[model samples]
Target: MFSCYYCNFCKNRKTTGPFTQIPNPKSVLILPKKKKKNRAAHQYHLHLSSVAAGRQPSPLRRPLSPASSVIGAHHRCVPVKLLLPPSPAFTTVVAFSAPAFSRRGPTSFQISALKPEEEAASVAKAQKLRALQTQFFSFHHNKIYTKEAVELSAKLLEINPESYTPWNYRKLAVEHYLSQPDCNPDSIKSVLDDELRVVENALRQNFKSYGAWHHRKWVISKGHSSIDNELRLLDKFQKADSRNFHAWNYRRFVAESMKRSEQDELKYTEDMIYKNFSNYSAWHNRSVLLSALFEKKAEGFLSKEKVLPEEYEFIHQAIFTDPDDQSGWFYHLWLLDQTVTTDSPLLASSWPAHGYDVLLVEERCYNVTVECGFNKNEDLLWKPLSASNSQTARVWVAHLKIPSSDLHSTVEVSVGHSKGIISTRGFEYSHPSMFSFKVHVQPMERDFSQVSVAESISLREENFMIYGTQSEESIINSFNQLSIKNGHESTASNWRSEALAKEIECFRELKIGKLTLARLLMACDVMSYPFANKLVHSEEVLELYSDLMKLDPTHYQYYKDEHSMVLLQKVTSSKESLLQHCFQYKDSVSSAICGPICLRLNNLSLSRMGAFEKLLWVQMLDLSDNELQSIEGLEAMQLISCLSLRNNKLRSLTALEPLRKLKLLRVLDISYNEIGDHSIDTTRYLCSSPLSHSVGSESNKDETVTSDVALIDNWEAFYIFKDFNLNQLDIVGNTIADEKFKSVLVKIVPKLKQLDGKLLG
Candidate 1:
């Protein structure tokens, strides 16, 4: 059995017990005895079991005191400092609401009852509180009782702290007091401090009190309280209950207001995370801090040498400790999503030593400076003419001079943002003005993070001195080896052997390093490098993916997608083999390594399509006049810009829904298919399905109008591709109502320039 207690602020006592289990005082009373002085006739015991079952309780009578009535749920109760301790994570708290409780006592909530002696006192207190509330409301509406209103609000708030109305009234009162000429600095500070303390007291009662926290922010904004003290209080609040979203938000506000160092906040987040790895608040806090801390780092903060390793390790440890925790996984994804500077080449290919103009190619349209440095006796730097900043404009012109006798010298150009250096041996030049050089630029399309990291790792002499100061090629090779290894290696091998060795090392590390979320992440990382860098497939990749599928069943599809890509990459070297697997797997090849080879051969009769995942770059596809019946495999082709499916066995237009994700699609050819007959009833059949109905509304239209007018007006509503701005459509041989179909199709795709090779007038 649980006991009940009453707070001095609120005269209500709360204790929850099952209605049938707890003894009913009403049943025990034989007749009316002397009424208890502290206990009011309105007080009654409240059963919690009924509330838990979603039943509304009967209306409660007016208590002797306003403090006897709790305004909000205990879960929402903003606890007072002198009352019970804070609740944890906003969950149900069970405590005996007795008077013998300390500041750090276990949290308890109950519907309170009053005693005989307190009944008289409660009535007087209720009367005083009523007078104060009435006075505050009068000043709020009339704006005459300023000083009295503020004092009344304070008194009313002490009884019912959660009431936003009284808090707002107090704010108006404080603002008026500050506006007066008598308001000195010390007086203002004293008032602000007092306000902050009141808010703190309210927060202790209800940690999630929105009004209290908001008032605290206003008080802090007035430059009255120490942010350090606020932070300390927030720290304690978070420690008491880490998932207090309000406290976390307040901490961020105070930290930002004080311009607190991100490093300190990051450390605090780390401490909280160490205490509870599942705390998403701490992880989210870390993400915001990282973004703020590295906002100005040109190459991005993660691309820095010192930062990536430590960050990877930290996230690794977090996930390793709790593999099921979503917080660390999300943070890891955020780390990977940071924009790595795009590494574009200054020149695509080596240039001949002549006085010809060189062409520079930049990957993206970002404005950047390009400098050409000639190294002979001394280094000379020169800037090329300004190039138009557009990603579509692939070529930039730069003048170059090469001497015939100075073939041993080198001419180097620095790409902006430390992308890399592109240089060529001095070309043979006859006349400085007559001869011109042509430099072809090949832009690297990969993210700059890996490139920058690889470059940084390769430049460390102490790490690779054993190989002797090597050429650029050897340094790169060594860097790849080191990166793939889980730990230090005695000797490095060629690409294939190194990849295999790394896989084995990852396996060993997984076994030795305790099976953790980090192990799975590390395994995925080490296993992916082989295919990402060297196109070497290992059993370890598929195995780890399988393990991840089991560990994170929620993301099983993701592992499947990655597994398919790895398998596709292994056979990419052989064009014939790649096409065979592409047909078998139905996935597009990575554009970085190979363009998606066309597999459309009418002679090769295919009946089915396979769903493939890694096709972010696929733009055009031709699959016309094949024995295809379903569009089941088209879901993963999100980048398809032009799709050809003319003269196939497609009987319904319903198959076109999967193409909605292909926002870039501009041309579609589905001509000469047995879609429907040349009857007006065909529109009814197409529009009847739920998927078709999603295309347009039938709400306002009559049955006949829905078949004609609604069908024409909202024709694009038939499928997901209604949004595609199709410039051309080929439905020539279909036996549908050609005129009506064309009209509706045109309305669906307004930019339709051609229909079945005929211009849409």
Candidate 2:
């Protein structure tokens, strides 16, 4: 018997193995290819069989079906293995071939099998689709936007609506068609609506698909929009998710384009807020609508004298209903903010009185100069009214005393700024009016109003110091009368008493381990009530603030600072006592805070002079914008690091010599001062002497006894702090000439890495 076995593919025999070569004894048979895709399976079979042999195999003689082969030829070789019978007399021959089957070959159009016939059909369809996609993309890349190109992109978009590239190509295709000068508007509108539908359908499939939304916006923006319908669509989107800011933004755009009535928009926002007061977007939108609605009204809630009490009620209701809702509180704040304003100038009485009178003026004015008729021209002392007030407003007071016999003296008043000065046209001797000592006090706002009111009262008390009990009683009576007129009974007899009561109440709450909103509000009201202009210095307030520090550690410094401010206000004697008190409580207060508050203390009364030596532990000191003539007291603070003396009255670098002992000092800001650096002796320590060793130290107390040398007359004389390790030095806003400063200062301060806020090379 003779038997033959064949494979779809064959390999050449490189070496003889196992089977013997056979002579021609049997006929050969080849099977036909089944179908287009199945031909690849046939080719794979042939290739496998050829590899099993050791010789180079011949290629398949038959052609492949169209779908499997790109070049219309079979690339695989088929090999046949034959087994010959031992004798021809026992003749029986059989041939066996491997099973015929098909595989979807690895190509761009490849599809996994489902059913045999289905997979073949699917693969053929995918191949045609891929070819079509390639042609379409090629046309798009080449900038072809013809009708056919548009159709192609439409089909691509149908397959992948979220694909940005296809959407962009589609937009380009439509735009190209519309760009033709002869294009009719109706035709364009029809095309645009169709494009809109495409995006709408895409959105229906995937609502949050960015490309679909963007394309819809683009289509509408090209003058094809029905804004009313667009708004309705956006409303639906927002209904799905009320907090969707994007949908809200789109709705706003449509509403604006359609010129939606402000009232209607406001009502819409109100509806949204009513649904969810915590929705920040709705609240924010409501605020915008309210502003727009109120802009034209003279007595609008956010405008002039006629404040919107109803708006206030609404906001208050929202906040009270949900205390945790920041949106309500934020809107409430916006409602309370001041609008555009007019002018009110301040009037200052004699220094002994130190009283301020705010005068209503038609024109805005800042600086006021008062001149009393005398033998020669004299300028009175004048400054800004307070730290928080505008610089344009000045308080002018003089120390001049008028003789009893010559009580009627003419005075000239002028108010102006950098532009020049404008004086009253005529000088006159004026008599005091019935309302001379009375000042109108407005209702205190929330939060810091207490501090402001108290500070004001403190100023008034200081001004009336010389008048004794009668003047004090008169001022109290004036405040009482004003409060009665305003229809509110005076909360306390006076500013001090009211402040003390607030302090007590704040402490009582702390003792119970509670700081409720009601209590906090009551504290604010109590502090701000009765129109007091005196500083509260209650120990209980300080203690309450200390307790608050623990409860709200994030604002610990703020509480400690308020505590320090309260204590300083109580310091009736020397300013050094304030510094001492601050130092005593230094464990609770931060170092940087003391300086500005200390400056405020000095400005409050201007009655302190001494070494700040007792404040030994303070590290950072900001003495900016103060009336300091010298830095003589800083020697005691050896641990000081940052010192800001900007906008001061120091005239020479000699005042800075005390800083030499402060070796830890690094940042020194003396900008905007009148200090000069003309050659002066600068002391440099050859060795660091212990802080204990004063100038009086008796180590062989004779002339030229120590290694310390004074560099005299050289520009290096300004280098006293060379050993102090000063890295940052600010001298900005000074009149120091470039020639003098460059030749002198930079050479001396070689260790400085920063000068006047600029980094040095």
- Number of the top TM-score candidate: 1
Model 2: per-residue lDDT, tens digit, 1-761? Answer: 00001101011111111111211111100113233332122111123211111111211111111011112122244443334333321222222222221111111212243798887998887787687689887997899987777777777666556567879888888878888898898889889988887876776665555577778878878886565678777777778867554466566677777878777888888888888876656766776666556564423344433434456557656655654444564454344331111112212111111122222111223434443333243654543321122333222223444344543444333322222222221212122212222222232222111112112111111221122344334333332322112222332234334333443454354332222222233243333322332333355555666566574443333334334434433452233334332211112122222121112232321111222312333444546565554454345344456666767655555446566655566667777766554332111211122222332332233533134322234322343444446677777766553445644555566666666656667
- Name the candidate that leads on lDDT: 1
**Model 1 Cα lDDT, one tens digit per residue, 376-482:** 41333322111111122222233344445555444443333243223121111111111122333333343211212112111111221121222223323322321
Each candidate structure's TM-score, on Cα atoms with residue i matched to residue i, is 0.43, 0.37
Q: Root-mean-square deviation of each candidate, in angstroms?
A: 21.4, 32.4
lDDT, candidates in the order shown = 0.45, 0.43
Worst 10 residues of 1 by lDDT: 1-10
Poorest stretch of ten by lDDT in candidate 2: 1-10
